[model samples]
Target: MDTTQTAVKLILDRWEASMHNYDVLLQSLSDDQLQKEASPGKNRGVYLLGHLIAVHDSMFPLLNFGEKQYPELTKIFIESPDKAVAELPSVQELRTIWSKQRTSLKEKVDQLKAEDWFGRHTAVSEEDFAKEPHRNKLNIILTRTTHLAYHTGQMIYLK
Candidate 1:
């Protein structure tokens, strides 16, 4: 309708497209294939999947949606590199978590008004937000959309 609404729609559309592309790519791979490295000595498909989930889970707190659903994943998937942790969640387990997390996140995101996207996220101080208005909740979506696309490109090598 308005310029702000159009802009928000564009950003969200890109995020959803990136997510859809990732889902299709991941679904095409089998468990055995996911376990293999995306490239020699690089992260595996499963590792990338977990890493994405961990990053997205953090958005809950950053966006003031709530506490992270899987804070433990931050240690295994974000703090440590692939294979750094002796034990990792099964591929199926990660898939289930990913689905649930995305579903809940979508519900919350859908409830937001267009103006809400321009509000300061929890991570930014009010003083700073006043000075730097671009650092808003919608910016997180833009950044994470590109982040997802980046990993999705890497995972393509696993196919």
Candidate 2:
């Protein structure tokens, strides 16, 4: 009901729509076709989707000062052709994770204070000190959401 919640809800709505569009686009391809590389150098639709899911997981851990965690999306390697291929999540699995993450983000962002939104970090300058840190708001939804939409365009256009 408040401004933060409203903004968070809008981000969640956009993300949810992206899931539907991505799912529909993938569903159109045959199994073999889905596995086919969109380009010789580029990752397949499944890989792209996995990466997107991993990005969502990244956001939570990134909010911490310094930490790393393996995302369930792409913890396994698939190189050399002899190593076993990592399995993609089932469609239902993808939907469930995406839905849960969006809901969590919506709640977290709403509860976060204005100071939390305004983040401080050191500037990349010799003169800048710990005390002279730069500030930025965690207001990147429009830009990053646009990135997802752009990647979707690539998925839709791939042969």
Candidate 3:
């Protein structure tokens, strides 16, 4: 495989690992624990997973044409949505969504040309990102991939 293809694959591989980790952690939690908040006001694992999906969904607009842009990762940080972390759909439901979304995202990453990797993307450096044109798409993928890891670690503790 060429460099670009390899780079894109690496990102997808790492993200797939992150998703596996999410599954394991969520599985360990008792159904009640699944809903337990990380803190007094924090979200639970179910909420966090939903928030994860929401976070990535936010990127769709930027990835598309930057129409429905938001300030940051979540509405997860905003008032909790009706779907509690515990109250999300069944594991099978989540599994299907997760599988589809990740595959689709990976396919998109694979399609980018070398130049397109840095194509005006503000994913990593949107606000906290340094003021430069260094917004590589791979970097953005890694950034969000790592974010999922961070939350996965937090979810482990909740159980």
Question: lDDT of each model, Cα atoms only?
Answer: 0.93, 0.55, 0.63
Clash totals for all candidate models: 0, 0, 3
Q: Write the per-residue lDDT of candidate 3 for residues 1-159, one digit (tens) a residue.
A: 888767667776787788678767766777677668776676666667666766766556656534332333254333456353234465455545556665666566556666576555654555544576556555666788899998888777686
lDDT of 2: 0.55
Per-residue accuracy of model 2 over 95-137 as CA lDDT, tens digit each = 4665676566556545656556545322223354234433333
Instruction: Return the top candidate by lDDT.
Output: 1
- Expressed as tens digits, the lDDT of each residue in 20-107 for candidate 1 is 8988988898989899998899999999999999999999998899999999999999999999999999999998898899889888
> Which residue pairs of candidate 3 clash?
46-85, 47-85, 125-129
Off by over 4 Å in 3: 1-12, 39-41, 65-96, 113-115, 122-131
Evaluate residue 92 in candidate 2 and report its C-alpha lDDT on the 0 to 100 scale.
54
Candidate 2 lDDT for residue 132? 45
The parts of candidate 1 lying over 4 Å away from their true place are: none
Per-residue error at 56 for model 3, in Å? 1.1
Between candidates 1 and 2, the lDDT winner? 1
